[model samples]
Target: MTASSSIGTGPGRALIAVYGLFSLAAGARATVQIAGRFQEAPLAYSLSAFAALVYIVLTVALWRGARGLALVALGIELAGVLVIGTASLLDPAAFPDETVWSAYGKGYLFIPLVLPVVGLYWLLRRRR
Candidate 1:
């Protein structure tokens, strides 16, 4: 397939690459946090693991050129970040730690908040 016609090629490749990196980061972080001290904050730890799973699904969807799946995953990611961010801010005691979306990914430099917007725009602009 030509580069322009495939989401996994060209610029989309960069997006996917970032997504892959995030998948690994979130997965490893969640694993360590959950395994070591899940009892400390079950909700936050579970959200971390869930965020990792979403990143994995989003990365796979983009790589495979599954537009619908990518859209859904990205949407969920956006909502997750917003909801989690707000909840954490409103109730600091509940979080007590960080999930990928906590504080809208302030811990990760807000990339998680922005990635989904870019991914959604890329997918929608592809004319697929």
Candidate 2:
């Protein structure tokens, strides 16, 4: 096959794989939080669902090679992580409980923090 197609086979496949994992993980966590005990912490649970949606969108956009959607999702993910991370750090009381972006995704081995950076790079590379 061609070089571009090869990319879609190797690194591209890898990227999509990571995105898939995040989608599954975030989606499940959000589902549990929102369905199980959302009343205890609506803000945190809602944020979890939001984060899950973002991950799902990001995964789909990347797999479909929809550059615009991918860019939008990645940008929003970056913004969410930064804003939430800072907020959790500065005002823990405001959070009440941890969402995926809490402490910039420290709970997820900081992949939540790093994924957007890598996604942005991938999207930019695809643009060229």
Candidate 3:
């Protein structure tokens, strides 16, 4: 298959796998936080849930080779990481607990910060 047509094959498969994993991770974390201790940090748990939704959509978009949808999802993911990361750092009191995006995803080894950049590059590179 030509490289351009292989957006969901080869390396792109790995990207989709990562996105899928992140979706599950963030979703589970959010579920537990919201059910068990949401009173401790409602904003943090809600952001985790939002991040999970973005990752879910991104995984599907990448797997389906939907470039436009992937681009929009990646844009949202990157912006969330940046804004939430900064907010978490600037106002630690506001985030008594951590979200998937806290401290630029330090909890996830910075994958949340890096994934959108990589996904964007992958999608753009495959553009005609």
Best by lDDT: 3
- Give me the runs in candidate 2 sitting further than 4 Å from their true place: 1-9
User: lDDT for each of the candidates?
Assistant: 0.91, 0.82, 0.92
Error of 2 at 28 (Å): 0.9
lDDT of 1 by residue, 23-101 (tens): 9999999999999999999999999999999999988987888877888999999999999999999999999899999
In candidate 3, the residue pairs with backbone N, CA or C atoms under 3 Å apart (3 or more residues apart, or in different chains) clash, namely none
| Candidate 3 structure quality by residue, lDDT tens digits, 33-87 | 9999999999999999999999999889888777778889999999999999999
Look at candidate 2 and tell me the lDDT of residue 9: 50
Clashes of each: 0, 0, 0
Kindly list the per-residue Cα lDDT of model 2 for residues 3-49, writing each as its tens digit.
33333355667778888898888889888988988888888878888
Give candidate 1 regions above 4 Å deviation.
Answer: 1-5
In Å, residue 8's CA in model 2 sits off its true spot by 4.5
- Which should have the higher TM-score, number 2 or number 3? 3
Off by over 4 Å in 3: 1-5
- TM accuracy, model 1: 0.94
Instruction: Quote each prediction's TM-score.
Output: 0.94, 0.90, 0.94
lDDT value for candidate 1? 0.91
